[model samples]
Target: MFGVGMSTAYARKLRWCTLNARFKDSAIVARPGAIRAGDRETFMKIVRFILALAVGIVIFSLTVAAVGAIGHGFYPPPAEFQQIGDRMSDAMRAQDQAAFERTQVELAEAMAAYLPTAPTGSFIFVVAAWITGAFVGGGVAAFVTSWGRRSVAMLVGVADVGAIILVSSLLPGPGWMPFVGIAGSLIAAFAAGTLVASGTRTKPSLSRKAAP
Candidate 1:
């Protein structure tokens, strides 16, 4: 028969293990920053996650390029503007202010054909492309970051959204596109982060039962 003292000791050990498991589980969800000393494996996993986030951004950019090409083919920009744009660049490089200014005005007029007047269908396609790129990129980031902190995956989405804003400013698009694109990017990233974080969570072991 088990003695009273021995039973108490067994219960205490179980309690300690339960608490320890809880702590470790919480740490697993956060990953990275909680790496215990002498745990080189965790440190390397974190490094890989960081590198994965960078690669995610590259993927996003490439997707945007491909999608943009497809969209442009459907609703191409003013054909004449390309030739005028080159002339404008040459004028500026040559320091021919008069020619530069004239070409600039002409280029603006050509671009205007699409801006503030292009069909809503084309605008939808372009905006959707950017959003889709961020969505798919975030998912890839999450998959690669599966072995580490999921929050890091979000950085890719945030960075891409910021880039979208910057590019939009340089080549002004419809006012609404920026708002929609930014919102969509964030939603996609949060979803990816949540999936990876939850999927990696550790469950307490139940394989062994304490002897009575």
Candidate 2:
């Protein structure tokens, strides 16, 4: 009887051990699955952010262009040569040198007809709009792609700066002012890209395991 009892106890212990082994195996399997799931969630979040940022940047660029176009009306033809030539012809035909000189002065004044002392304000608005838009776009792109945010941001910034400079050149102003605005816009875009790339939120990891 004692031998039989000992055998029964050994059998119970073995069953318990088997159950514990199975539990541990299940726990181990669950842990990796949980980790993988967490990683996937994080990747998805990053992707969404990048997409949002790209859209925002595009919107901002368009806004800047629209504002500039609205502020300055349609781009005028080269007034210095064409309009002046017309005026000179008219003056010469009328036999009036004084009138021709007057026409030149009038043409100069017309070309300088932009609002005075407010160019700085306009520049600020343009730069702000562009930077804000670019930042948002870059952030979204970075969030979407785990890599390449920096390159994207830099590219966008350079393009925007170049565009702003070109537009500024077309405006009626002292030649130096548009160049300055372009420089400022470039600086602002770089800063904005950096900010957006860094702003993407990383996902947290999750895991699970069976208790020992």
Candidate 3:
């Protein structure tokens, strides 16, 4: 009877041991899944943060451009055309070919003087406006679609080139300044898009099956 009792106790102990082992296995399996879920949530938060930063930069740029435009309109540049027209009027009135030729030289000088003087505050504002406008415009364009993004880049390039051409016609200087703005905008938009896309791709899919 003692031997039988000992056997029964051993059987009970074995059954308890089996249950405990099963419980430990279940806990171990559940831990990794919980950790993975936490990691995915953390990654998503990081992605959101990055998107917010990009959007903020774009908005800041637009604000700067708008302010610059308002200031420029209020304080217009020197009127080169009015002086030139006055000279031409005098030349026509005098009806002296020699005097008109001399007046033409003087008018040219006056026009040159009207051309943007270096170290002007307006120059700084213009630069800021171009840079900020490009960045904001490009970012908005990028958000539309992939094709729209590329189109934005191209459009910016063309617009900058056009501005440079237009400015060059009025004033003499290097025409490459606007190109720099275009390139900068394109690069910024590309970087923003790539970062956002990569972040999206790296995000874990919650619907995936957990490991056994």
Candidate 4:
């Protein structure tokens, strides 16, 4: 009888030990899956952010081009400058580096002479285009991102500022032009981000309050 009792206790203890081991093994198996899931979520978020930035940049470029085209239509460049542009295009097509460089120098000289004499309206128009583009692009970026909307908007602003500086360097503009562009883009982006965030917050709260 004592031997039987001892055997029964040993069996029960073995079963308990086996169950405990299985529980620990299951927990160990679950940890990696949870970690992988979190990593995947983070990676997807990054992809979404990149896509949003690309879309925003395209929109910004298009807006700037459209507005600048309209400005050009209203305030046409001199015929001499147009001729220079034609030559520049021909030089590019012919792959004549010397001709291209000569045309660029001619264009720069002509612009330097003409811009100071150009109407104040033209300068204002250019600044307006940059501001409009920044506002629209930043707002769109904020709207597109699922998270980090403000950061995305700010990124758009920074991109615009960089582009403004680059273009100003390449093509001569008034010394104050870049500063204005930088300030306008930053303000527009901030306004866009704030507006979008407020709109998003209001919608959700309204819906929740309305829910019975």
What lDDT does the true structure give each of the candidates? 0.77, 0.61, 0.58, 0.87
Tens-place lDDT digits, model 2, residues 85-163? 7987999899998989998787666556643434555555555555554554444444445556566555556666666
> What is the Cα root-mean-square deviation between model 1 and the actual structure?
11.2
TM-scores, all candidates, are 0.62, 0.44, 0.39, 0.85
Q: What are the per-residue Cα lDDT tens digits for candidate 3 across 1-212? A: 99999999999999999999999999999999999999998887656544544554455456556967775676565566566667778878988688778777876677577544534555555655655555554455445432334444345434544554565566563345455545654565455455444444455553343434
Q: In model 2, which regions exceed 4 Å deviation?
A: 1-9, 73-159, 162-212
What tens-digit string does per-residue lDDT give for candidate 4 at 67-121?
Answer: 8888888887789999999999999999999999999999999998898888777
Model 3 TM: 0.39
Best by lDDT: 4
* Count of steric clashes across candidates, in order: 0, 11, 0, 0
Identify the superior model by TM-score, candidate 2 or candidate 3.
2
**Per-residue C-alpha lDDT of model 1 across residues 58-132, encoded as one tens digit per residue:** 888888888888888888877687899899899989999999999978877776665877778778887777777
Off by over 4 Å in 4: 1-19, 209-212
Show pairs that collide, candidate 4.
Answer: none
